[model samples]
Target chain A: MKIAEIVKTLDGSVILGKENLEKDVEMGFASDLMSDVLTLQTSNILLITGLSNVQTIRTAEMADITCIVMVRNKKVTSEIIDLANENNIVIIECCYSMFKTCGLLFQAGLKPVY
Target chain B: MHFQYSIEGGDFSRAGNASSQLKKLLKQLNVDSQLIKRIVVALYEGEVNIVAHAHRGTIDVDIEPDKVFIRLSDEGPGIPDIKQAMKEGYSTASQKVREMGFGAGMGLPNMLKNADKLNIESEPGKGTIVELTTLLR
Candidate 1:
């Protein structure tokens, strides 16, 4: 799925990397734990997480994850946005819970990394 | 090429800086994407381990034609039981660290899984040293 389609499905707003809306995402992984994210072997995955921190962006960058959807209306600071932009990672903000966000994306044909 | 990064313990904000820099360096060096990913994951975990447990540390990286080697040595409360610490679900991270989406006992194991070779040595009250190597092929 493309990042733009994920935004439409989840009613999310692009907080950064708008130019990357057409980027292809092969899978999705939802986790608040950066450790678990590191364990994933897949690339080009969309990270659906509620944890808003610099490590979240850092983890995505190291894992080659290009997009992130922050669920539960989590507050995203400018610092986080700056880091995401520096790494060319798309950040999306959505008001749905993590479970709902994952469900919506999965329903739209995005498979899990498991 | 050789690179060194200093890590201040308890500085969660700057945890993965070294890993990020190393990733960029490896990319510029034209290392294979898969090898770069593994190196990044292992190195990032090592960085986090220091930030979560040690007082401070330094990461020494050596990038060569055939492989990349990383050594992370920290001055902090070292792991007493290497065997237990190497367990897939064993971690000694503080509650605060765990709340920040880490400390799920997967860091070291993840590093081991990604690195072609991993060596860990520690002294109970002194510190710990983790050495990781990955082949570029």
Candidate 2:
């Protein structure tokens, strides 16, 4: 799915990389634990997480995950957005809860790449 | 090329800056993505470990045409049992660190898994130094 579609479906706001709304996301991984995400290196995966810290961007950068959807209506700070911008990763804030966000994406045929 | 970053312990916000910078360097050099991923991931985990658990540390990145080496050294309470620390889900990080979405204990194992070569030397009370190397053709 395209990032724009995910944003529209999830009612998410783009925090960074607005220029890449048309980029395709092949898989999705939802986790608050960086360790689990590290264990699953899904290239270009759409990462959905409740964690809204700068480390989340760092984790995504390390894993080469270029898109992040923040669940539970969590607001990402400017620092996090700046990091995402620097890493060239797209950031979106979703109003849906973590479980619902994951379910919606899964229902949309986005499976785990790992 | 060589890059050095002084990682400040207890500074959670800036933990991965070194790894991120190194990734940029690798990208500019047009290094292999697979090797860059391994090098940066291993180095980032090591850098996070230093920032979250150590008193102070430094990350040294040595880049070459065929290999990238990272050496993280810290002066802090060393791992008493490296075997236990290496376990996938064991962590000694505090509640604060856990709140930041870490402390699930995959740091060491991830470092080892991502790097083609790994070496760790630690003294229980002295400090710890982690060495990682990734090869690129």
DockQ of each: 0.90, 0.86
How do the candidates score on chain B by TM-score? 0.98, 0.97
- Best by the DockQ measure: 1
TM-score of chain A of each: 0.98, 0.95
Candidate 2 C-alpha lDDT tens digits along B1-137: 88888988899988888888888888888887877888888888898899889999988888877888888999999999999999889999998888788898999999999988999999988889999988887
Q: Model 1, A1-114: lDDT tens per residue?
A: 889999999999999988889889989999998899988889989999999999999999999999999999998999999898899999999999999998888999999888
Q: What C-alpha lDDT, on a 0 to 100 scale, does residue A24 get in candidate 2? A: 96
Model 2's DockQ score: 0.86
In model 2, which regions exceed 4 Å deviation?
none
Q: What tens digits encode model 2's per-residue C-alpha lDDT throughout A7-110?
A: 98898899888999999998998999987787775588999999999899899998999999999989988888888888899989988999999888888878
- Model 2 clash pairs are none
Docking class of predicted structure 1: high
